[model samples]
Target: MKVPFSPPFIDQDVINEVLSTLESGWITSGPKVKALEEEVCKLTSVSHTVCVNSWTSGAILVLKWFGVKEGDEVIVPAYTYSATALAVIHCGATPVMVDINEDFTVDTSKIEQAITNKTKVIMPVDIAGWPCDYDAINELVNAPSRIKVFNPESEKQKQLGRILVISDAAHSIGATYKGLQSGNLTDITIFSFHAVKNITTAEGGAICLNLPESFNNDEEYKLMKLFTLNGQNKDAFTKSQAGGWKYDILFAGLKVNMPDICAAIGLAQIRKYNDLLLVERERVARRYQNFFSQYSFFQLPILEDKERKSCFHLYALRINSISEEKRDLIIESVTKTGVSVNVHFIPMPMLTVFKDRGYKIEDFPIAYDNYSREISLPIYPQLTDDEVDYICTAILTSYKKVIQSND
Candidate 1:
């Protein structure tokens, strides 16, 4: 049996939604996009949400809105996907890479040390759908000592008087922390709807606005919508209305708006996610946990604890006491069995772009350790129980073969 990793869960419902959008004839940032944003708002309980073409776009838009510019710094985990750091780079700011905890989330303690007056934002990624410690992070930014060091250069920054927290929740839409959803856990959170994500719009994302009460999320939503459409006061949907043809460009903004056609796909998936889809994902993860626990070499990922529950986006299983070379060989062996797997990421510091920017992988030992041993297993709504069993069996057999050969 051939097992594919993380295929988008496209069904008749998704098809119908797309068909409906096509039939409507208004596909570009129309009612479907608005509806998808509303559904996300409901799921996350955030006051407002703005849909964008991609997570990177949403992150850049948010950073720009906060006035992050040259000489500014944004703190991010070295263990995350490159998009997190790339967003900061696009805004002409430096990405201060921090080490991650064993659970794969950013180390909050390490983050405090990285803070400087130039620090404008702290982007904590929910690696593998597990929520980070937002409470600690929020407190760290809001602490008097930290605030005293913060020298606000922009009007937006001065108004807040602290570093903004943006949750890179690309893999953790449904995840919960201390009874709060991932999107609502930070000052702002961005959820990805990429093809491989738990919720797919083919390629799309949403920015959940959960700023403090002093800030009007509704006004912020309007500004974000404008920013996604080249700073036009009116969107295509609104301009389609009679007498709305003429509009003003307030400022230069990125054209990263989500079209209705793409939003249709995610709308269908997210509507049923919490009830049926998410449950199945959790069930499959639990099965993997049960099967892998008996093996001495398997290090099961943390799915849940006393205060948090993951969305089970990626089943990042780690092989204990294995060198990076052995892990690659084991992956090769597993692939021969017709099972598709992947590594979550290589540390950002190890990547060419960041390496050239003076980042050393040695600075983030934990991030490197996590990346070396990590193997992301196939975990999605469509993966059947039998397929999962086959995958587990394939990995175990391949591991034994690789170990015996090396011995």
Candidate 2:
């Protein structure tokens, strides 16, 4: 009856792919990585994709590529994982924290208010695999008023003449917004293939490039590949070829390239993602909704609506009218029943690093509200129907106990 939270779905296909990489002798950032990038482009219909060691690395690379440097600002939701803000910090820029909407996506209205002359990028996170409002966001950035206020310091920024939008799509690889996939919905989108993600590469990420027509995506893809490999004109795989030993360093770049071994894992998973893996996750989420809806206290996560479809990465069930303390007690009770659960995140302002940097939880009221009562239930593809029922029962019983004790 034990229900673990978000285990990576590893079947025979994943194992065989990894085994093949190990046998190939070229297990570094080679064919497998390239293939995974291509597969991601095909799935998301993005023009170009660059695989990296992790989402943080990919974000930093993209931020740096867009000329985000010291004194620049990037707008991000306070509700997201720290990595989103940390990427901006690594580039010596500040993260302008904004609150989120009830659906767990960054509030577009808040983003518009946060924009300033120093704002270089707007990173909207897709919490729990739900896509954000890209159409509104895109229009906001491109609006003549916003562009007029933009101060471009670098050559790249000057070329674009406006703020950039990067989708923090770590949880939303398969999600769709207005019939377009998450990756294709933004100027650039980064997808995480972390261990617990819908598609796992053990530990990896991909940057989907869909810049405006003014910029060449194919050229940017070449530059991004070099950026991930220490700015070397040739990668390890290319250097392994005959007479390719000597190469030039274009500039100081990051060593964040994804190895073939890790890419192989995600490669196998994504091939069957749309048809099989994503469907099962959605099915489990629907079952949880069905079980929890009858109770007044249970608030179900929105899986889809008329405009968007989520990847159903996390079943972020919320307990209505409960204090944070009561939510903790309920989680404690549920754990005793052998159901492992989690909180999506603690607001950035509430965390020590951001707090010390002078951010206040009071500024992000909505983010705090969502964080307090949110409980991320397991919704992986491999979860069985029986396990889903057990998990729902455990939560119901635990909530009753906590309520009685508080009363």
Candidate of highest lDDT: 1
> How far in Å is the alpha carbon of 356 misplaced in model 2?
0.5
**Model 1 lDDT at residue 67:** 96
lDDT of each: 0.95, 0.94
Which 10-residue span in candidate 2 carries the lowest summed lDDT? 1-10
Relative to the true structure, candidate 2 has a C-alpha RMSD (angstroms) of 0.7
TM-score of 2: 0.99
Compared with the true structure, the alpha-carbon lDDT of candidate 2 equals: 0.94
Which run of 10 residues does model 1 get worst, by summed lDDT?
151-160
Name the regions of candidate 1 deviating beyond 4 angstroms. none
After aligning candidate 1 to the native by TM-score, how far in Å is the CA of 45 from where it should be? 0.7
Q: Which portions of model 2 show Cα errors greater than 4 Å?
A: none
lDDT for each residue of candidate 2 in 1-407, tens digit (9 for 90 to 100): 78899888999999999999999998899999989999999999987999999999999999988889999999999999999999999999999999999999999999999998999999999999999989999999999999999999988898888999999999999999999998999889999999999999999999999989889999999999999988999999889999989999999999999999999999999999999999999899999989999999998999989999999989999999999999999999999999999999999899999999999999999999999999999999889999999999999999999999889
